[model samples]
Target: MSLKVLSALDVARIQLYHFKAIIIAGMGLFTDAYDLFCIPPIIKLIGRIYYVEEKQYRTTPTVVVSALVAIALLGTVVGQLVFGRLGDRIGRRSVYGLSLGIMVLSSIACGFSICRTRNCVLVSLGFFRFLLGVGIGGDYPLSATIMSEFANKKTRGAFIAAVFSMQGFGILVSSVVTMVVCKIFEATSHVSNGQIPEQVDIAWRLILMVGAIPAAMTYYWRMMMPETARYTALVEQNVLQAAMDMEKVLDIPMSQIAEDSLLPSYPPPSYPLLSKRFFRRHGYDLFSCAASWFLVDVVFYSSNLFQSQTYHRFIKDQPDVNAYELAFRVARFQAILAICSTIPGYWVTVYFIDRIGRVKIQMIGFFFMAMVYFAIGIPYKYFWSEKIGIGFITLYALTFFFCNFGPNTTTFIVPAELFPARFRSTCHGISGAVGKVGAIIGTVGFLWASRIPNNNGKPDPVRMTVALVFLGVVCLVGLAVTYFFTRETMGRSLEDNENDDE
Candidate 1:
């Protein structure tokens, strides 16, 4: 029978299975958001809890606090690069399980927070934070690949972007849980007025414990999910199974699957990627992805960390808030706004990813981000210019709105799609790891910039210049990367990429 002859009923089954995969991938993305965000409120809580024992916990210097954050983001950098490659080599499903396991274990360990007589507390918290970051790094490429593979060409961008949109959901949930936990810890905290209390009090331990919520959710997927059919087919050469999986997704026929999947007796198309013709092509796909992802991540993290300070100032100044009330409100507001951004972002990526293509959206978003971020530096240089300051901040938020709708959504989606099967997971992982470098750069750099105040008690021009330059460079590079490099991979069959490998 011809490809056109498949029953409509068969196509429906295939669609249902693919839908399930996207949701499952979304769950993993949630963990990434939760792991990154769970730290901020705890930073506040820990400060209050151990103020008197400041030396004991090394809470004495702002630098020390900043150091902890840097280490964790750095951990994500390591995880993305390292674990990502591991996933490609071993198998996507196994790595997915392993990454989730590490995340769950580290989160629970963080709840046992400490760092007193010995290095136990610091060691424990830092170790777990790092491990969780790594898990997030690995998950980035893995989940994106899974969603894209299972998605229909018509809706691939939307489905994957929606999976990523769950990142915002994770942020919103972490904020809510932290808020609730902070309030409860406050009421029973045995301390009042946002003070840490003279005793080894309730703040940090309570704050860290909320991480368990995501840990709990990890078990939800233990039964319902499997490896992406595309990954299974491409890397493992399990054509029959791959075809079966696709049939479930596209609702096609068994005979149609067999006919469609027939391997050419002789190889046809080619990806210069795997050709021995290229120097060190064996790992180039993996490393190049890592490098590009790492570069993009730094910009993303820098903008997010810097922008968050809009509210961070309030937390720093308001010491009298109820512990729970304080954490909850900040998270709620941030999450709410971010979630609002995701709704539109999800719609755009899903609707236009195929139509407009990835490069165009990424170029436009990064360009706009460069202009807006530079504007932020202007008011920082002139501290008294509150009107311009507010305007810059608003523009920055608008940039994020555009950021998510555009580059933020596409970059993650594109890398997973670009590479062939054997290298796809590893390549994406490498890309993820590279992204982590960006995150580390952003985390460390912005943590310092957040403190940049001018001689007039306003933001220093030097600091603003540095921030403007940093973001400017990121957007500029992104523009170049998308323009001179990168290709479209929206509608091709995975089967086609495989035959090229031969």
Candidate 2:
């Protein structure tokens, strides 16, 4: 009976409800990207506001910057483990709205973080952002699993990719928002002797607050979404309700689904995650997904979070620019990069993911990522020159392109498809949690490794070259894992992917 009910979902035609599911789930990811990526452009502004030294604004202490950025990532690891398990234990719908609720509240709180002392303000912002990260973390497994379970097998990859693609838009929008806010402030405020204007403080707060809008808008729709037919039938053992839910969503007759629920029921497999049978079947796939996600994020987040520092290295030295001007320049560059490379890469994946299969796309993406990183790193000084900076930026943009088109999309897609319904959310959560660990490594490790105080607080040429080489090596490792460990899940049903029906 469970197989029959699931088959109905697997073979169903793409419909309006499918698109609805994509938007409802996709918006959470949009908010996730906005909240996560938006901070990099504003970190300097925050430092200027609070971390003043001898009446001169100092570069935010490396430790303080890492904590500000990495605290949320740390919270993400915890959220993924806890909320991921809860998603499987409770119904997806029951806890779905709760995560969004946390996001809405926390985003607002982060913007309003104000205290008497610098430490108090920093701690308050970090605390709220941690809660924001928790909410963002919950969305990963929940959104990916829900979209995978709701989609037809033929377009499952595309559907899930579509949901993930919202991330690109979120990133682009954050850049745009930061750029626009900076431009607004730049016109009204003036800097003298390099001191930041008071209005700069308000700008960062507004930018943080804006992330709440989309998440808040989608909360009602997310609450209205029904539990996936697979979870309802396979996990909840509720064939009749599953059938009824499908009948409504698929706009099919009750007659079509009613016949399946009446069929004889069979018990589902009850192996725990630790059993040898479980390891024998899924251990390598989990390793591949986790490792690939881990590796990709280490490179991706390091580059993404500190892109401003990277840009400053290549641009002509401007002796007269203020903090707002510096931020505007960085945000503008990032927005352009997103438009030219990042956003397009995601849509291209959406277009080809179902057609080419996930494994090929991932391997191809990892391969090109390595090639591009090497291209930039090998002739480090040649590309670093101000005259040829465009060449370096082009190569840098390609990494973002291939990442979104490659492992970034597939890692999220494959984990949801590779596991059984009972463990789908849990496994994907573990995978995503591991990925966040990689993000923390990237954010903290690369920030420390790349910054050299001896180089007037700029990234040292040798260290930057080494960092690029390391990322390239990580990509090569990802490519090997994709080839050896992951399986293709293009046209297979979830049960078929896991051999669950047998």
Q: Which tens-of-lDDT digit does each residue in 447-479 have in candidate 1?
A: 677565556444445765677667777777777
Give all candidate RMSDs, comma-separated.
4.4, 2.2
Tell me how many clashing residue pairs each candidate has.
Answer: 25, 0
Over 317-399, each residue of candidate 2 has an lDDT whose tens digit, in order, gives: 25346777767766777778889998999999999998999999999999999998888777774556323467777888899
Error of 1 at 109 (Å): 1.1
User: In lDDT terms, how accurate is model 1?
Assistant: 0.61
User: Residue 131 deviation, candidate 1, in Å?
Assistant: 1.2
- For model 1, the stretches where C-alpha displacement exceeds 4 angstroms are 1-14, 52-62, 114-120, 188-191, 197-209, 212-224, 244-250, 259-292, 313-316, 319-325, 340-343, 383-390, 451-461, 495-502
| Candidate 2 least-lDDT 10 residues | 312-321
